[model samples]
Structures are given as structure tokens and as C-alpha cells.
Target: MIPAGRTPATVERAAEIFGKSFNYFQNQRLWEKLFPATIKAFHRAGAQRIVRLWDEEQLLALAAQRELPFDQQDIPVLPVADPQHPKPAEYQDEDLLDVVEAWEALHEAGSKITQRAWNTYVSRADDARETSAPAPDLEINGSRFWYRKTLLDWDKTRMGRGESPNAGRKKGSKDTTGPRIRPTAIARLAAAEGLLRALPNLPQAEMVKAIATTQNVTDRQALRILHEARANLGLPAPSPTEKK
Candidate 1:
């Protein structure tokens, strides 16, 4: 129901702004980025009355509920140009819930993105690309996707060309392949492993040395990997040794 005393133009404008805000509210954790866009959208829709709905107190309260960062104490309120234009006391709670539910349902059918994980997946792709010719072939066995063979193909192709598996390209260009790390990619490898089989059975010194050689990393880098692996595996970290 439209608020009492609001003109038809005001109600229409509010509805338009509300429509654009569905996607932003779906990821409740991303309210910081979404809130400002919502305020701007309201302004663009000529719903200056609804702009008061985004004051600092309400924003901070919403942020607190989501455990998000919102440090602004004062948000500048836009002036209402027409004195006779009616402003609602507050937004209707029922209407807001309806839109939020619709957004959640929409996202549930699409990507289950609570936060943007593109960089994380891209990092995984780069690691797999290190040893494969083409990118890791996407294989779906039931619900699981495997890329082990694709990585092997990448490695073979690079060797055939006499180029290193992870060759560097010029900056600012698209890097569809993956990241090029020095010999010190052991830590990343260890991180990918699960706690159950992540660690090998060996003395601390020998284990570090073995990883260093196999991963083509420095002994120091290997030690760092061991530290991280142990932490991930719930094992006690080895004492740091002096560099002789």
C-alpha cells in the first residue's frame, strides 16, 4: 500500500528504485557496497523522500546485523526540492521482505555466491595450468569436477615447446593461463591439500629438504610450507632453526 499523502509520482519513483536493489540485497554480507548504490538509485528515480530511509543509524544497524564494516556517522541528506511533496515516515517492512525473498530465491537457483570468489577460482586455474598444455579439462564425475589430467597435458605441451611450464607474460595483458611462481610454489600446493593426507611421514629436516627439491624451492621456502602445512593439519609447528 502506498503511504498516505505521497503523490503518485513519489510512489512510482520509489518502486523503480526498489526494483534495481534486488540483486544488491541478496548477498547480505556485501551491504557496504550495496547500500550506497541503493541510495543513488533512489535519487536517480526521483524518490527523494525515500532517501531519508538510508540515514547513518539505520545503515549502521543493518551493518551490525551482517557483521560488515560501516564507519560513517553522518550521511548527507539531500534537500527536498518541492516543499509540498509528501515524505513517508519509513519504508514498508512487508514490501522490503518480499523483494529480499525474491532476490534470495533467484540467487539460490543461480550461482551460490555469498561473496565474490572469482579470484579464488582463478588462482586454482593458474595452479592447474602450471603442468598442462591446454587449461585443465573440466571433467564431472557425478558431482565432482577433476582437473588432474588437464594439468598434466599443460606440462607436456610446455616441455615439448622447450618453454617452462609457467612462462611469464607482459603485464596489463589478459592472463587466461595462470600465475607464474618462482620455485617457491610449495606453500600453495600444501594449502590445496586436505589435512588427512597433506603431510608426509619424515623427520622435520629431511621432510623440508625433500619438499624443497621436489618443488624446486629454497630450503627456507620449504620450511615455510611445512609451517603452514602443520598449522592446517592441526600438528605442532616445528621449531625454527638458525640459518647456518
Candidate 2:
């Protein structure tokens, strides 16, 4: 039931914004959230309210015995809303659980960047003449290294290069086999996934190096993203030496 002077629209808006919110498909956490939700509201910018019904006689009796401020008449029975465009109050970004998921995704991506920088690099396809070559296969003969890294501009390149290899779901998906990297390409790697350049572990370093080499840039963007992510996670920042 809405307040005496309030209109139906106001009640509808409240229900839309908060009723479903109260029923977010969470597990046992939903019950745990009530306390934190109340606290969050208290710390929030607005003077918020937390409304609930005390149907259990035991609790109601305790509250009544203690002369609680609550009144059953104050608990409004909110009506559900139409599903088109949700009301503004129903905006979930303000909710903490939403924040948790966003943080988790970012953190997971960042760690993957740290541990498998090359895989991260490979995930992003080449930009120019888009080349989707698999990580290069190196034949190391003493000092004379051998691999190929020349790239075809993706725009000029076509999928199903009769001899080229492919991965991922689409024909234009990632290159699991294409060109090998030459000695010169090493200097150019790190454009996309940043520098797994000289990473001690050869497989990852080599894969990312191939991607960066094909990408043809010196920007350490991926490494920077990972490093910053570490900082955000409360880990120490990785310096140039450490990243290298």
C-alpha cells in the first residue's frame, strides 16, 4: 500500500527499482546482504530507508516488548512494474554485488595478463592486414635463431589462406599457424600484449613476441595494464626490471 498522498506511479517506481533488487538471484548471501545493505544505505549519500515485514511472532513480540518504532502500517505493499525501460532507482550500478562482479572480471583478466602475457597477446588479433598466425615455431641453431614474423595487413589479408592455419570459432578467427618470427621481429614484438618480450619462460614469451612483432608497435600497453592491475590488487608495482 502506498502512502495516502502518494500516487500509483510513485509506488510502481519504488517496486521496480527495489523489489526485484531485493530478489537478485543470489544464494545464501541474499540473507547475509540485509545487514550490509542496511549499512551501505546508512553510508550512502541519501537518507535511505530499509523496509521489511516482521511476520514472525517471536521477533514482533520482542520488538513490541522493547517499544520498537516500527508500525505495520508503515510497510507499504509495493506493486511490480512494466518491464520496458526500468525506473532510474532500479539502476543496479549503485548496488555492491554488481561492483563485486565487475572487480572480479577485471582482476581475473589482469592475472591472466601477468601469467600468460603471450596468450593475452594472441587473444587480440593483428590490426593491419590482419594476420592470425599461430605462435612461431623457433629452430634455434646455436647463435643463429630462425623464425618468421613478416605480417600481411589484415585489411588486405583474406581468411582461408589455402596454406595458412586458423583457430577460434570463425574463419577469421585467431591464427594458430601462420608465419614464424625472424630475429628482427623480436625488437618489434609487444605492440599488443605488451612485453612478454624476454620473459624467462620461452613458450609464452615467444607467442606474445610473435603477436607483438606482427602488431608492429613498441607500446607496452598490455604490461602496463597488468602492472596497474597488480597495484590495484594491493600488490607492489612491477618496475621495468621486474617486468622485463
Candidate 3:
């Protein structure tokens, strides 16, 4: 029997499967096997790899058809059900094999979500869109900022050990090996507002350098944000830095 006092979100989540593609696959394949599992993977090393790997036109075409041949691996896909979930109450002895068979059929059809692709997707997980959204969330950016502040409260020598002073986990390796850093927007706007607290404020060239070295977010994404800020927020456009 389902838990009686589940959280509201948990109950809602149980009702809707996020599986848009793989759900379609299961009913079509008539999966039959002893035990079946579905998994997803991501690759995160480079942007060019992201662009080169996925053909948008092909994906759109595949979606419109709704009859995906399982062997097509280039498309991004996810399974409908959590593979590790407990079998339903009606799963009798003979019928259990059917689930395994389904896993085999789906496996053969070629919709495996590889580990590399999953890692890549996670690497591109931007926190900005999350913060600006309606729902309340523990803002990852805000968490990091607070963590940084707690480090400064400790002695200079204690802070250098690279531990999260408040949270007690080791600080990210970058926190130690790299130069002190701040947000790109903070750096860009600080000159105009005269708040350089705990960060470097450089000339135009170094402003660009600070963006490249400290922020490490993609320039294309930054440019998009710049335009949106200018139009929507009424902030002036930041001029491109002449390459030094």
C-alpha cells in the first residue's frame, strides 16, 4: 500500500511520469524479461561537443513521427519509470519475467541514456534561471556566497586550509588554487557603484580578463544575459573588451 502521509509534492510526482519518450517505447515494445533497468549519462567536457553531438532538426523530426526506432542513440531521451522502484502488487511470478523482457526490448531499441551525456547535462546546470523563477528554492548561488563569507570570518591561516568553515566540507579545489574571485555582474557593476568588497576591480581589459578567469561561464550565455539586462532591466550594454 502507498504511504498514507506522503508530502504533497511526492504525491503529485507519483501521478506524473516525466518519461515522454521512453514511456512510448515501453508500450510499443511489450517489454518481457527477468529484471530490467534504465539509466542516463551525460558528458561535460566542452561546449563544441554539446553542439556537435545533437542535431536539432533530427530530434524534431523524430518527435513528430512518434515512432522512434530503439537503435537511434544520438537523441536525448529519458525513461518514464524509476527502474529501482518496488514491483507493483499485481506482479505475479510469470509476469515478473515480462518486466525483464521489456528492459531487453528497450535496451535493444537503443535509447540508453549514457553516463557521459548525463554528466554533461549536469555541468550545464545554470543556477540563474532557478533563482529568478517563482517557486521558493535554496538558491545555490546564495549558499556559496554565505559559505564564502563564513570562511573570511576564520583566521587567515584557518581559511587557507580550504575547508568550508561553516558547512565543514572541504572547499572546492578552485577556491585554493585560484585567485580570489567574485561574480561577473558584481565586478562589472562595482566600478559604477564603488563597491569592490573582497574582489578585484580592473580596467576594461582586466574587466574582460576577470570575466574570463573568475566567472568561467560561457561568453555566449553572458552576452545573452547582457542583452536581456539592457532591454528588460534597463541596464546599459557592457561594451566588448578589445582582445589584449
Candidate 4:
């Protein structure tokens, strides 16, 4: 008998308790034959791997019948649900908002996002969808829509992080006057600095070009930042005619 509220176990764990290799279970297709109902596949959050879970009590029963050397205390319990996994919220047709409606909703929710800015974000989200990135909750008849809860949740998270609820500006936009740089650019800047240090012999011009290409900055701006970075590292500036 299956225990109530029993957590599922991974097939790998089940195979171990049954004193059988995973290949043995797969080759014989024992899961299909003996416990088809107990088999389930779950996709972990933000991962491509599919985890196969099984009913633990059923596996233990079969193991006991076969006299497999298994201890009930040693069985590993896999969590039934991932806390980070996104759950689809219950929503109705009235809760869905088209781009214009979503923009208005954002404004009403104190987002301070202009319609023009909102449209830019929508375009970016559409482009991102092509690469399997996050996008609107729904698209139909050439219109994109998001659930009210989804938009609100996104705004809440942004506000919680002390960032503006408005979506990020376009790449290379002339808006560097902000006090804080975007987190991703900061990370990439750090990486570029590390590369600079590791390859000190590399020409500053070449390094500047690389940083400009990666960070979407102009060569002049890249050169300025590179000079500051080198100075911080106690390295001398390369002359304009320096070929090394």
C-alpha cells in the first residue's frame, strides 16, 4: 500500500534501493511493466534536465518481495515541488491585458512607465521570445497580452530590489547619466578588467576595441575606462604608437 503524503523518489534512488543498476531498469523496462502509474517526469526550474520520479512505497514493496537488501530508513525522499519553479496563476479572460491595457495597468500600479517606453519593452520581450527567453503570457491574433498577476508580480520584484519598475532601456542608448549601471553590464565590465589584467602584453587599443564591442561602448569611452583600469592596477598607459 502506498503511504499517504509519500514524497516521490528519483528512478536512480529506486534502482539503488532495489540493488539494480539504472541500466538494468532501463534495459528491462521494469518501470513500465511493474509500476507504470508511479512513473512521472518533472522539469527542474531553469534547467533542461528532466527528472523522473517514482512512487517510493511501491518500489519498497517490490524490493521486499524480491528479498533485496534494502533499509526503509535509507530511502531518499525527493521533494514533490520545487520552490523556484513558476506556478501558473489562476486567471480569467478579464484578467488578461493587451499591450495598451498592460501599459495603462502599469501606470495605475505606480510604475511611471510611458507608453513609448512600454512599447519598447514589448518589442524587446518579443525579440527575446525568439531565443526562448521570458515573454508575455499570451499572444493571439497579432496581439500580445500578459496576465494581470504576472505584470504585478514582475513590478513587485523590481520594486523590492529598489529598481524602477520600468523595463530596461535599449542597448547603447545615450542614457549613461544614471547613478547605477545595469547589473549585467557591471558583471561584464569586471570580466573585461580581469581579461585586461591577464593579458597585460595585449595592446591597449585592441583591448579597448574588445571592450567597446562587448559592452556596446564607443572606442573613446572604452579607451578612457581602460586607462582608468590600468592606472588602478599600477600599469603605465601605452603610447599611441605602442604596437605591443
Candidate 5:
């Protein structure tokens, strides 16, 4: 019998599965066999309420797609009838796989979620997005922010480990790491504000000089970038009377 309650979030569902299957895998070391047994245990324990929660989550996801303002003709409109409660039908295959892989990796690593483990988690996430069917072209949603926060929390959890921060990344891959001056509009704005915070009422020439020295660029180039960044944030340009 299905439980009588609200649906849970994807992560919450994954956690439940982990709780149920953890011991089974620990004793038997059989991941493939543990899954079916866990589902059977869920029913035996009248924990099928979790399945309903999983169903609701799927419905909400589908409903979110339907609510998008943009045309979603290419999106799949799955039926919501007697939704498959959990397992391959109710939950996403990729999501389940992510939880499975992450749990096993972390478990093997003595439950220490290191940067390398995070890398594998993220690599699987990337694969999921690539292989999954196209979702609706909806407006920016909270899920993006939620996922970012989740990743950030996970990163923090793995802090202080001796793991390399750049694990699993190939050398010379300077996209997100390494030294580079690829400042975005947000970064530039932040720099301008930070400069003002550090040196209140700083002169334009001094600001330019500081940036130039830090960035190893000519004063003129730094001044140009500074002016543009200040303009972007609507901050007033530095006064000419300050030190050059």
C-alpha cells in the first residue's frame, strides 16, 4: 500500500534508498542484487509511502515543464496516471545511478567525500544532462540555484582533505582553474567594489596603478578596464586629484 503523504525531493529520495541499501551492500558487496531486495524491503516495512513521494516529485517536474511560457513542442508530455512508484519507472535512471555511484565511491573511500569523488559525481551529472531527453525551454528556475548550493555544500563537506583540488582534470585545462585574467562583468564589478572597499576615496590614477601592478598590465589598459567596470556598476569614476 502506498504511503499517504507529500512527495520528497530527488536528493531526499536518494538518501532514503541509501539508508535502505547501505547495510545490504556492506555485508554482501552486491550492488546489483541489493536494489531489488531494497524495494522488497520497502514494501515489507510499509515504506511504500516513499514511492508516492517520488511520484509527486516527478509530477511536479512535469508540471513545471508544462508551465513554461515558451513553446515546448519537442518536450515529452508523460502521463501522470498511477505513476510508477520509485524504481526505474518513477525515478530517473541517471539520478538513481548518480546516487549509487556516489554512495559506493564515498563508502569505499571510508565515506570521505573528497575532491576526486566529487569529480566523479560531477562527471556523472554531465553525462546525465547529455543523455537525457530535451527538457522544456523554461525560464531560469530555482533548481539551478538549488543544485549549485548542493554542489557547494558537497565541496565544503570534502574540505581539508589532502585530495588535489584539480583531480581528474587534464593538465593545461585552464578553463576554471589556473591563473588567467578572464574577468566577467560580474567579476569586474566585484573588483571595482572591492577596490573601493579596500581604499576608500581612492584616486583614479592610484586605482589604475594598483590594478596594473596586480595584473601585470600597462597603466592605460588597467585604467580602461577600471573605467569600464565602474561604469557597468554605475559607480562614479575616480577623482583626478589623487596620486598618479
Candidate 6:
């Protein structure tokens, strides 16, 4: 019998049946390519946690086809419980754009910012009051995503002011007279921000250790970077008595 509850193991089993890596489905964008309708319906239905059994059946049927580059139309349509009732208005926006898509959109709009820089901007959006960057519109399974139109609108507003689509100090703003941060330091802080977002529930001390191991820095240095990352992301710093 098919599993009654959708869990990580269920996803893994489905991935195996679909002949795709588990991570492929774990990433929302990649998974949407295969089940766009299901995703749309899920989002439309207020994104509740319940998983429909028909979705699993659709996966199995698609796998049976053994077709490479399957057409979305070939997938079974999601049946509505009440055909007489009209569905809620469709989401007017385009498919939710992940960080990668946002980065690409900025580049296409003549911004010269690197992907890392774009990521840093996104990481700091909630705290970086100096810039007008928009915070993520939604998060799915720990990954943050923004609406395509929201990003394009932000880009257009920036471009209209003759500013680069990338975030920076406003024109005629006072330059920082304090000691400049090293490029390596900035890179490490950004990397730490990414790790913190990925493993948000990890203990502070353990997170520092993980960063130290991955970044090849001393624990003290890693702790410092993690603290700075937390500040940038508007997350609270660990208590002084907290072990590091």
C-alpha cells in the first residue's frame, strides 16, 4: 500500500521510481519542472501540508512510460473534488524565482554583480535597510524564493534611477571612513550566512565548529564570522554564556 503520509522517505521512494536523484525533487525548481500542475495546485490551495495519493500514482505512471524529456501534458491532471465549484483565482505571478533565477535576472538587466554578491544581498535583505532589496516572498522546504515580477520591479526601479541593479550606497552618500574589510573576510561571512540558512536549527557552538571545518578557519574566527552573519541576517546572536 502507498504511504498515507508524505515524508522524506516517501519522497526518496518516489525519486527512485522516477529514476531521478532524491535531491532533484528536493530542490523545488527542479521538481516543479516535472510536476508543474501539482505544484501550482499545492500553492493555490494555501500550501497545506497534506499530500494527495493521486500525485504518487501520477509519478508511477510517468515512470512506466520510460519517456525521456516527458511533456507536461502527458502527466495526469489533478482532479478537483468539486467540479461544479470554480477554483480560486490563479496566482497571477510567474513561477516563483529562486535565488539563482534572481541572480540571472539581475545580470540580464546589465548588472555586473557576481552571483556571490547577489546571494549576499539576498541574505542581508531583511537587515540591509540602506538598500531597497525585497525580502524573500516564500520559503519551501528551507529554500527561499521570490516572485519574478517583484524582482523585475525592483530592477526596473533601480535602473530608472541610473543605479546598478545590484545594491550599494545611494548616490552622494557618505563613504565608510572606518577600516575597510578584507575581500577574504567578506567572502567568509557570506559563506557562513549560506551555511546558517541551510542549517538553521544547528546549535550555535556546533555551527561554529562546522564552519571552522568547512572554511578551514580557527574556531574563534569561525565564531566571529558566524556572529557577523547572524547580524547581517537579522538573527539574534548567541548569549555570551553560550559555548562556542
Best by TM-score: 4
Tell me the lDDT of model 5 at 33. Answer: 42
Q: Residue 111 error for model 3, in Å?
A: 21
RMSD of 4: 13.9
Residue 81's lDDT within candidate 5 is 28
Candidate 2: tens digits of C-alpha lDDT, residues 3-111: 1121222222322333434235232333343221111111112213322221122222332343434332123222213112234354232221111222232333342
Encode model 4's per-residue lDDT on 36-100: one tens digit a residue. Answer: 33233332233333345555665676565544333322333423332122123422223545566
Give stretches of model 2 more than 4 Å off: 1-69, 72-89, 92-176, 179-244
Per-residue lDDT of 1-244 in model 3, one digit per residue for the tens?
Answer: 1111111111122112223344443444312221122221111133232211112233343344435444543443322132224244422222111112223322333535334432342345345321111112122211111121121222122222233222322556445665444354554444323322233233434444444444464555444433443454454444465323
lDDT of 3 at 48: 36
Comparing candidate 4 with candidate 6, which one achieves the higher lDDT?
6
lDDT of 6 by residue, 163-230 (tens): 44343454564775754455557778899999889988788888888889987899999988998899
Per-residue error for 91 in candidate 5, Å, reads 56
> For candidate 5, what is the TM-score?
0.23
**Cα lDDT listed for each candidate:** 0.38, 0.30, 0.30, 0.56, 0.41, 0.59
Model 2: lDDT to the true structure: 0.30
TM for every model, in the order presented, reads 0.23, 0.17, 0.19, 0.42, 0.23, 0.34
In model 1, state the lDDT of residue 51. Answer: 24
Q: Which candidate comes out best when scored by lDDT? A: 6
Flag clash pairs in model 5: 3-49, 7-53
Write down the RMSD of all candidates, one decimal each: 20.6, 21.4, 20.7, 13.9, 18.0, 16.0
- Cα lDDT of candidate 4 equals 0.56
Worst 10 residues of 4 by lDDT: 82-91
